[model samples]
Target: MKLYPIEAGNFKLDGGAMFGVVPKTIWNKTNPADSNNLIDIAARCLLIEDGNRLILIDTGMGDKQSEKFFGYYSLWGDHSIEKSLARHGFSKDDITDVFMTHLHFDHCGGSIQWNKDKTGYEPAFKNAKFWTNENHWEWATKPNAREKASFLQENLLPMQESGQLHFIQNPDSDFQQSSELGFGIYYVNGHTEKMMIPYINYNGKTIAYAADLIPTAGHIPVNYVMGYDTRPLLTMPEKNKFLTDALQKDFYIVLEHDAHNQIITVEQTERGIRLKETFTCDDIF
Candidate 1:
């Protein structure tokens, strides 16, 4: 199996929102903010090429939103999914599966795109089966007031409309291996209901896609949870358990939202789980 780091694009989010309750004096040291107090955010997606299947994890926010809509996020950077795919000599059509960690716009927005006629939306990966759990599918589709803004209908619905959406059954178990995808789905609810973090076995190492649960190396500390999380109190314990297991099992974390640091490992320090080492996908894989 081969893994490629796909750079969808970059945007800026409020640093305060990214690191909830964590003082700017602390988080700013790792993820420095701009003059507007916005921190750099990456829509980093992962592409796995195994035998006949090319699975993509998390399609970054697509370029379908209006300029006014995108201005809210302060979108930046020229890196795109097409350019990144071409770098690996592949295209959207080659993707057989799109494993969404969650339905947040930044994470799964790129799953659909505007059709050629500009009449309606269509599945961006024409040949890929979009993978999401039943719980999350419902949670996103019938979003609560707090998370309604993040779960855009344009980013979803089209996959189901195109008859390419598939739900991972019974995703309540922790680290349950999906028979078809051949990856362990680590379910966490603090960030969102049933966010499926894919754990892949590669080269004698377990590489975990650290979706929003552990978005960046800076978020290694259990307390450094995102304010956007629906339940901040629940996030603390969930992060603690995940970090403890990650340290014990020697799992490499593949960061999805960290713009600068791509992958990281944690150590059980006296203070708590802390960042051990940071590296790129090429350095390790």
Candidate 2:
């Protein structure tokens, strides 16, 4: 299987929000903030070419949102979904699977786009089967006040409306049951209801798509949980266990939101699981 890093675009978010309880003094060292105190982040997506099935992990925040709405996030960078796809000699129509880790706007917003006439929204990947667990679909569709802003109805609903949406978890299994997305799915709830981290088997190495679970290499510290997480307390155990397993197995972590660092390998340092090395996706592949 071949994996490509799809650079959708970049955007800015409040430094405080990204780091959660971690003070600005601390997070700023790693992610320096601009004069406005917003930290730049990448909506980097992953493309999997496994046989004929071309699966895309997350769609970066699409360009369909109004300028006013986008201004709120301070979107930046030259990388775009279309340009990035074309860079790799592909296009939206080439994708066969849209495996969303969750339905948060930045992760799945690119799933739908505005029609030419601006009459209505349409699925960005018309031929791709948009994949998300049934439990997550319900959780996001009827979002609570805490997460309502992140779960935009326009980004979702259209997948189901397009008759291309499908659930991953078996009906008999618990909503949190671990499953596979062609690549194995490691289900965790700390970030949201049921975020599926894909463990992709590629090039004789196990590369995990660290979706929010480890937003960036800086979040390797166990206490660096995002306040956006519905259950930060539950996140501690999940992070600890995942990090331990990753180090023991020598897994390469493919970060989705990290702006600068694309992949990081962890090791059991004297201080605990610290980053052992950092490299680009091309370096590993």
* lDDT of candidates 1 onward, in order: 0.91, 0.88
Residue pairs that clash (backbone atoms under 3 angstroms), model 2: none
Error of 2 at 181 (Å): 3.7
Point to the candidate with the largest lDDT. Answer: 1
Strongest candidate by TM-score: 1
- Write down the TM-score of every candidate: 0.98, 0.96
Candidate 2 lDDT score relative to the true structure? 0.88
lDDT of 2 at 235: 90
* lDDT of candidate 2 over 1-285, digit per residue (tens): 888999989988888888899998998998899999988789989999888988999998999989899989887778998998898899999999999999999999999999889999999998999999888999999999999999999999888889999989643421233344566777888889888888877778889889899998878999998888999998988899889879988899988889999999998878889899999988987
CA error at residue 49 for candidate 2, angstroms: 0.4
What's model 2's lDDT at 187?
Answer: 81
